[model samples]
Target: MTIKIITPEYVVFEGQVDSILLPGKQGEFQIFKNHAAIVSALVNGQVKIYTDSVPEKYSKYFTKENEAKSAYSFAIRSGVLEFNNDKGIILAE
Candidate 1:
């Protein structure tokens, strides 16, 4: 799946990802490849990014924890996230 995180000033991140874990208004949830269409409110919290390999350009904004998961994460302000087909987008304030 592909993901993009955008703010009013700039596009924070854009690349292919294996999964995304978001802090939803109701609770935290993970979205995977080919996830069903969804539109949800997000809370200010951590956003996790998982991929087979880290994109070098965006490495500064993420931290790789364990090799098995190849997970990276960064804090996100309040936002809205939408997913459809193989794409997911986050509109952050």
Candidate 2:
């Protein structure tokens, strides 16, 4: 599924990802491809993105070592995540 993480200044991340793990207000939640439509509030924690099919050029920035084994994480204070029509959007504050 395509994922987009946006902050007030700029877009944090935008790409296709295999899975996403976030700290929700209720609890931690995982989002995968074709997930049901929903919106939830996020808490203070890390937002992990698993990129299985990222492009080579962009992968260099987000990936630490290798593409397959590497994942990207962002420290979020508070935010909202929305999933709909096979797309995931995160707006962080």
Candidate 3:
């Protein structure tokens, strides 16, 4: 699945990910490939993206969280998430 994280300034991250963990208003939730469509409000927290690799150009916007190099994280103040048809987008503050 593909995911994009965008803010007012610029696009934070955009890439294919195996799964995503987001901080929802009620609690944290995880989304995997082929999951049902969803739209939710996000709170200030971290967003974790799991992928096989990260392109060098976009690596700067993400923090390496594990030795395997398959997981990365980005921080957001707040955001809205929309996911459908194996794609997800986050519009952040």
| lDDT (C-alpha, whole model) for all candidates | 0.85, 0.81, 0.90
- Native-referenced Cα lDDT, model 1: 0.85
Writing each residue's lDDT as its tens digit, candidate 2 over 1-93 gives 899988898777888888898999888999988889999999998888887545554454343424447567678899999899989889997
Report the number of clashing residue pairs per model. 0, 0, 0
- Candidate 1: deviation at residue 21, Å? 0.5
Winner of 2 and 3 under lDDT: 3
> C-alpha displacement of 8 in model 3, angstroms?
0.7
lDDT tens digits, residue span 15-89, model 1:
998898999988999999988999999998888888776667777777776645778877878999989989988
Cα-based lDDT at residue 59, candidate 1 = 78
Ranking by TM-score: 3, 1, 2
Worst 10 residues of 2 by lDDT: 58-67
Over 4 Å off, model 3: none
Relative to the unseen true structure, what is the Cα RMSD of model 2? 3.0
Cand. 2 Cα-lDDT? 0.81
Q: Who wins the TM-score comparison?
A: 3
Per-residue alpha-carbon lDDT of candidate 3 for residues 1-93, written as tens digits (9 for 90 to 100):
999989999888888999999999899999999999999999999998999877887888889887556888889889999999999999998
Sort by lDDT, best first.
3, 1, 2
lDDT of 1 at 28: 96
Q: Is candidate 1 or candidate 2 better by TM-score?
A: 1
